[model samples]
Target chain A: MAAVQSDDPGLTPRSTMSWWFRREARIAPYLYISPFFLLFLVFGVFTVAFTAWVSLHDWHIFDTAAGGGTFVGLDNYARLLNDARFWRSATNTFSILLMSTIPQMLLALVLAELLNDRRLRGPHIFRSGLLIPNITSVVAITIVFQSLFGRHYGLINVALDFIGLDMVNWTSSRIGSHFAIATMVNWQWTGYNTLIFLAAMQSIPSDLIEAARVDGAGRIKRWWKITVPLLRPTILFATVLSVIGNFQLFAQPLLFAPGVGSMGGNDQQFLTILLYLYNMAFRQFQFGYASAIAWMLVLLTAVAALMVYAGVGYLNRRENRSALEVERMRERANARQEAGA
Target chain B: MTNVDAVKAQSAAGPTPGNERQAPTFKPNKRRFSWANNWHYLVLTVALFISVFPFYWMFVVGSNTNADVAQVPPRITPGPNFIENATNAMNAVPFLRSLLNTFIVAGTVTVSAVFFGTLAGFAFAKMQFRGNKALMAFVIATMMIPLQQLGLIPLYMLMDRFGWVGQLRAVIVPALVTGFAVFWMRQVIATSVHDELLEAGRVDGCATFGLFRHVVIPSVRSGAAVLGMFTFLFMWNDFLWPLVVLGGNQDAHTIQIALRNMSQTYYADYALVLAGTFMSLIPLIIVFVIFARQMIAGVMEGAVKG
Candidate 1:
């Protein structure tokens, strides 16, 4: 702001009330936005950087008493890289992420499409009912699911026995454990995504669909051609969100078993990367190596997110570009008619 | 027929013309939507059934003995032992205390995050300031970092130094103002609050803050409400940090930690474990039930784009 102080009493150096007001106006926004930056720096950014530094040291979780940990150069990182357990956890994380997320996205989309009907009146029940699972704490849902997926006497096993089918040991076996954990993740999240997609679908002007209907487009064709194309942004949003959230999958896997220090399983079948970090830091008291694992998680999440963005972005643009071609043809026809006139 | 006769016919069809979803402008025939020929409700029914089944099963198993849950048919009904199991569950772990503690922390975090988010969001959306874009970018960057995981060890030590370990403040302070909250509110403000309104507020010599309080707040009330609901849900369900910092404080645990402790301690006591889990779900279930409509509309606000 320009300082236009004058001989006037309000603007004068002795009584700079008006000048102060102008200055305040100029500076108030920074004041408003500072809280997030301040808190995030102290808590979020600083802590992340601190984790990296800690990874370079020989730090025990409880070694804060006697002048803290010793500075060991790069040993923790080396151990983390060469460790089979870390690789297992990383592989488990990605596998669960894919298994859970792909089915999740498809199911949420299909459910959203079904609920997007204009004739579906007073759907608050369905919408809210679907969201109940999402609202439940991961701890609660994982435990409940673990029960249903129980081996011998569990309800699922009983059902399978009644049908003369083989019952699966959910937690003990690798595929069974991953499937059970994924189901817990899916049940919790699908409803919330449905609402998000419903919102996105609602905004896709109905007349566009009506236009396609009039043009003799089949039901599935119209949906694939028009609705899917318009829903690009929301699809990308949900995909990227799932990438970030499920990649850092911790709570469900942590609480999937019954024991205190279970580590996903005896053989670490369902051990997520974050769960491994927790086990390392808390259970084993290896804070330095745990911090290294944490850094690796950040890198993996970043890579997954970028890949989703690029891949989804390309898919969206490819189809939307076709629509743009049709628009260009129409515009060319209109231009020719105007020239003749 | 006269206009009066037309109105009479409409009234007879439905007691009130207000019952009609849309006014008959272009389409002469007012088509009433029926459930017939629509298989969508079938999909919805199955979906709702799946969604509700887990909780129902939780209730059933929770109200029965471990042996009853193990019965051949698999007990699917709520039993009379719920209150008894609840008492045992409470005694075993700090369920009730954790519920109260979770409420306090989640409530405080929601209020502070919303207020700060609105202030910052309004500034970024409507008001001009130096380094505005840079600061906004910084906030967005913060969202991408799984800072909870990234900063886990350091934060543990930090909380210990501040004498906040085993205290609610350790969990509460770190999450006082989140990046997503700021970004969400900014989207709400940018899309919903119009420039003409802000200009009018400015013409009346309203300060920047006044413009936000008067013009922006009223317009973004629904968005604010939605953000509050989301914030509360996330904070309520937050497990990792609360588990870490408050690990030592068994009595001051959040419901998630309490549930974890209960299920592990009474590992074979499925009834007791499930009872604790069911108790923890009660608050959020109630919130979801009551605010269903508003929450739906709020998600429809389109934070992804706006």
Candidate 2:
């Protein structure tokens, strides 16, 4: 009986050496969750605080010596405000953001609506194919795009020539550079956005479309009225994400330029804010100014997010009010019919 | 059929043709041709072409010589110089070493994220602990702050302090547990794993750690797989962070850094650059092909919840 009891796994007595196992159970959750919090404290929270500290001082990149730099509070910010290159980068960031995001979102929405059709054959194939560009590394993407947009022998220019168009210098011209970079951005992201929008569209009730059709609404009208309104929240979400992502556009423009420089182009046409910050800290070794740029980018992203949030809030409220009005109209009609009876 | 009958019918219907037309519109007609159907196929085909054409072009360019690539109305077909171009690319940089380095970083990060993320996710999903709500909230909030922009300066400084500036661990250690991965795993665990099974494990004398190891981990293996795949892909494609940390340290460079180096070193050598790019992309393409469906589902799930 003793041997049988020992053989039973659950009935086996815990040795004194294994007492820590019982104690460990009580704090197991804490132990489980500690790694994330610990890492985040060091890498995420502390780093931001340190960036703020670094921005206040005139810290050079290699100034590792103790007490090496003097503090000049807000000096970096002040200099940034007056910096022409900084302003140009800011404009370039916004231009690229708008150029890439707007069309990408619209195209994604349309594609999602189309793909939402149940009768569409082999949609899984299309969906998987769409994600190919996204899975490709940005480095590979940039190299391929550089060759495609090359001035002399690029496939794009070659095709343009086939169509009797001039061979536009993709790298030298500002609009041309922005357009090429935006094309890369769109090509990579449009599929991702499509999948997101498709998820949203899938959640929308089929009965709603059937009801609209029964009410004599055309397909387009149903999409515009029922589908688009229902997907407004998702649209807002995707837009905010795109805004945040586009502000930090880096690799495409970095490789798109004629030479391997962070200037983005000869005339600084595609110099995004993040690339600019990278250039300052790594290339120019201005850690303090780069920290300032990082903070400014954070601020810009926050403001953009806030603007979209407010816009979405207002739109939601208006939609609610209009829906309420329609409900009130139905209630009044029912009351009038009862009164007549 | 008379004017009088038509007038009476229109008056009774309250001047609305919708009721009269609703039945035919709402009926399921099997043989009816749909313009919308044709439009959908057309759009999907176009979008698919746009997505896949660049990759196809990469193969074409990579397989051709420089002269062939630079031809007017550039060659659309693959040529016979694929091996030659690939050889030239390998000679230009430490391609295999960089690939190994990238695999190391990505593999370590993926394993760490999966293991640690699963632990935290299981805790958040199942166990009631002190500061759990606040901690989960903190994790979610961390997802909003872009890591590269805010952390680069201080992180670089930290790496310098640690003498790990050019080490693979500099990238791997920091990316071990991402906020998004933790949140995603939590969501997966909360929805999929049940309290009853955990209670059963407890009754069987399974400790908390044992419950997680034996019950929770197995149950959420699919979610962990998704998280691992995404983390691997993100780390493999990562550029800005590695570029900064491993700057000018070609020996420690990842595949992306190597590709960047090749692009510059082989400037105007389109075939070699394309070959390098193609080689760097092959692993991701293979992984994507194998896990395409699961990946699509994972992305959609993340989007919907996130």
Candidate 3:
């Protein structure tokens, strides 16, 4: 009976097939990971394509004019490229980025250095203190900042006045408004960057610093020669993140700046690209045009990121070359000294 | 080799003479207390005050009437009108429903996120399944995809088709399995959970589910707690999705939606709005303190490698 069962083709097929399935069980992991990709394809990829398509057509949500969407190819792109509002928003975005990210990263690095000092106690408390702004809801922080920046009885201006400065028309003036918004953004983000930088700094070996110190290097020299060079990767990472974040600046600026739903100020000074896109899409119902702007923004961001990558790479290569030269010279000098001795 | 040693020898001798430089054994000095050590403390203390002062000031403003709040130089002290302001805010919107809705949505998201995130994490980390590497890479790449601006419209449409519009699940359900939680859980599991233990359970005839529950779940309890807390926090403070879907339905609003509506319509009522805002922060602050360790660890863990 056993021999007959073993010789049966049906049983043989079933057993070998099951073994193959078991051997190819790696497919289950793909299945496990497929849900995100599937959702992203439908929700992310398709929508992006649809948005681009819609941007090309002059379509209304209500479809009032001739069943909606006259296929006027490239006109939207032409207009968006030439649009003053688009240029203005891009300028505002960069301006705010400069105002917020530059000082923010610098201050964060200094704070991180202090935190990294061996003598400093209760690093946890300092770490927690740095995280408050990160964890606070953007809404709550915006509302509070709005109240504090109020022109008449605002706490910030009042404090400024107490220090012999004029009561700045923070929201009414374009630059003032941008600065106000930038201040809030910096406050909310500096701590986050500090934590990141601090973590990066901690990973740097203390032995390097000790070696530098033994070589008679001062704090400043050590920072420049060892710390800054080693932290370049972290800086590049933080910068790219900051760039992306700056382009997507919405909530705080939207709240702090005048004009409902982010028209920027009276002068459109703080109207970010995202805010402009939002207005175009939702407020004006120009889905097609908004999509073009979004795609353009993405392209621009990618280009900017690529440029930074190239610059960082070039600088690193140059530094490495010079460092190698220095090593070679030092080695030759050591050989001569050893031969003379 | 001689050349290399000579170079090293020269470099070592370049500073402080070899004997002085080699005195790495120890340098003992009297522990003189300097203000520099306390300087960091002072700076951090000031930052902490700035961080906490705004919330305290919100309470102070909340207790005052509108006139009192608008007074020049600002009222630094609390007034006696907190009850009136709170009552006005409560009456303005269905605050209780919002609280309940927020809690339920956050709770559901937390539970689902922890369960799915943990399961997916374990599978990716431990299972000897095919395509594991590709799946892990896909999950990591999803973190870089800027979903906020990119996926908003399509996601909204999806929710619409599913008839989840104006429902809290519209926000909660899609977020149950995200790139962040999945990656985090996987990392935690890889470090904490051992493969041998799972094998041992299997050898003992433990079913897959039984192995997960009895062996895997207990091991990753702390990781799950951290994920759960953050999931709850994000849901609680989520503005745009709920704002878009539930804009017209005041009864279906969360605290943020209700608060935004109040502020949008009644920006002049600084006292009442501040009261509502202050009330909104209470639950989060309380939760944060209760889960302080996990919260801190979660932030550190996420930032450490990144």
Candidate 4:
């Protein structure tokens, strides 16, 4: 045993200096990653805890009161639960999130499929073009979109008029406002998501598709049976990412709802949670109340993200696109083709 | 210090030719577009047009007179008023200064994020220390925090206390380190830097830092550059936080803030504002032109590999 122990390079008994050197090699990783943890502790972990703590108090930035404000012990949270604007804003957030995310994700998958075409010409140009909107400031895009979605003589309205359609009040009405703002979010993100999906799609081994084709499957059939299932993990990851980002939905709605005091609309029609939080903290100086809203927003975002995970799981069960099911689908497809022939 | 000198000398010596080594082979596309692939190209072209038309429209409105912008058909073609509108935009807002401020913020943020992210990414990828998995998961878990929106109040207070309020540092520092960049670099380094290479470095008496500086840095150069591109774009385009912190300090306003100033007007000068928007897109457009290939490869790598 002693001979074996000495034979092992790492465990060999050596001088204290050698042992210390070995110890550092193990601990050096901590030194490497400490900066992130330090910042995470202060800026990330500490801020979250502090935000929660602040939400429990009656803190006001201007009052400069002692002890930062009285401890309300869930009073702020209680108020938030009853706040009408909060509910309205919550609904708006959810609706806009759905409106933006679903279409954007669908469009991205389609575009990615197109971009992943092996024989596509100038493919690099198209990929880069798609990402331009993402790289351009989201705020800047919102500003441009705000102009484009103008009430009259705006590009969209003019386009609508030319198409023999009535131009809806984009900034004034609820659905109109949500649709316009959602369009901005959709346009800005779809391309980036397309690239992500494209990358994932490209990595899907050609053997899988070729095998499906050899099994007498058409292109669309092969894609549905094989590619879609394989891309599920990447899709879920992309969805969670979009949910986290879209839930914030601040600058777009704020800038889009022009002349409405940045309340998302005159009636707060499309007011998101973050915008509402901004108003509560910055406009009303209700830091405590705003913190509560923020806390709730985070929780809801987490719930939404987790629900996506579970929802996809539920979809798997309901769709039941197991290999057996796919085989059945392929057999049905082949039968139809034979009958048609 | 000696490690730094050694790296300088080694890199100055340049890469050693390795014609003997087996490299991964790729079949290059030698075929151009054929008639059968016309529809695919057409679809991509249409998508490309829609993707890029917004910038074109921005230019159209920017270079045109406001009267031309308000026309029924709207001026689809570029007008000759670009110089005038640009002059108006520059005069109306401190755009030049704000542009300079944006460069500083984005530049500093990119450098810091890339450097620190590369360092930590190397450690995470190669190191076999305790709690590596959990710490990495923790890093990833924090990505969902949405720091800009959630921590607004406390961050403001912290900045206020630190006397960084309305200073560019307020924008630069908090953004210097992000969970995404760290996580991204981690993935990049993990896949790109092979274990055998690090083993070789270690056998050559390279310490942990030495391995990182030499073996890791060169191997992960493209990844670092990609991370830097993303970080730069993110920092350059950052809005809400800078708007909140730099609200009081116009001297420190970023391009986004300046553009916001033009955008939030009562009458809304479409020509001037769009001109400002047009101006802001130029730098990024230039960057895209230069690094589009690298950026595309970078995106694919991060997505597919990770």
lDDT of 2 by residue, B1-306 (tens): 554554565445343232334324433432433332254687789899989998888889999888887877668999988899999999899999999999999999999999999899999989887788998999999999997888899999999899898888899989988888789889999999999999998667667777888999889988888888899999999999999999668789999999988887777888888887898888998899899999999989988897
**Positional deviation of B298 in candidate 2, in angstroms?**
0.4
- What fraction of the native interface does candidate 1 get right in terms of contacts? 0.80
Error at A282, model 3, angstroms: 2.1
Candidates sorted by DockQ, descending order? Answer: 2, 1, 4, 3
Score every model by TM-score.
0.87, 0.90, 0.85, 0.87
DockQ category of candidate 4: acceptable
> Which candidate number maximizes TM-score?
2
**Worst 10 contiguous positions by lDDT, candidate 1 chain B:** B15-24
lDDT of each structure? 0.82, 0.84, 0.73, 0.81
Worst 10 residues of 1 chain A by lDDT: A1-10
TM-score of chain A of 2: 0.88
lDDT winner among the candidates? 2
Ranking by TM-score: 2, 4, 1, 3
lDDT of 2 by residue, A75-179 (tens): 999999999998898888888888998999889988888889776689899999988888888888888888889888998998899999999998888888888
Candidate 3 regions exceeding 4 Å error are A1-31, A63-68, A257-261, A321-341, B1-33, B207-210
Chain A alone, TM-score per model:
0.86, 0.88, 0.85, 0.87
Which residue pairs collide, candidate 1? none
2 against 3, candidate with superior lDDT: 2
Which pairs of residues have clashing backbones in candidate 3? A26-B130, A54-A288, A55-A288
lDDT of 1 by residue, B130-179 (tens): 78898889788777777888899999988878899999999899888888
Candidates in order, interface RMSD in Å: 3.5, 2.4, 4.5, 4.9
Per-residue lDDT of candidate 4, residues B213-278 (tens digit): 889999988878888988888888888889888978989999998887777873368898888888
TM-score computed on alpha carbons, candidate 1: 0.87
Query: What's the best-to-worst order under lDDT?
Result: 2, 1, 4, 3
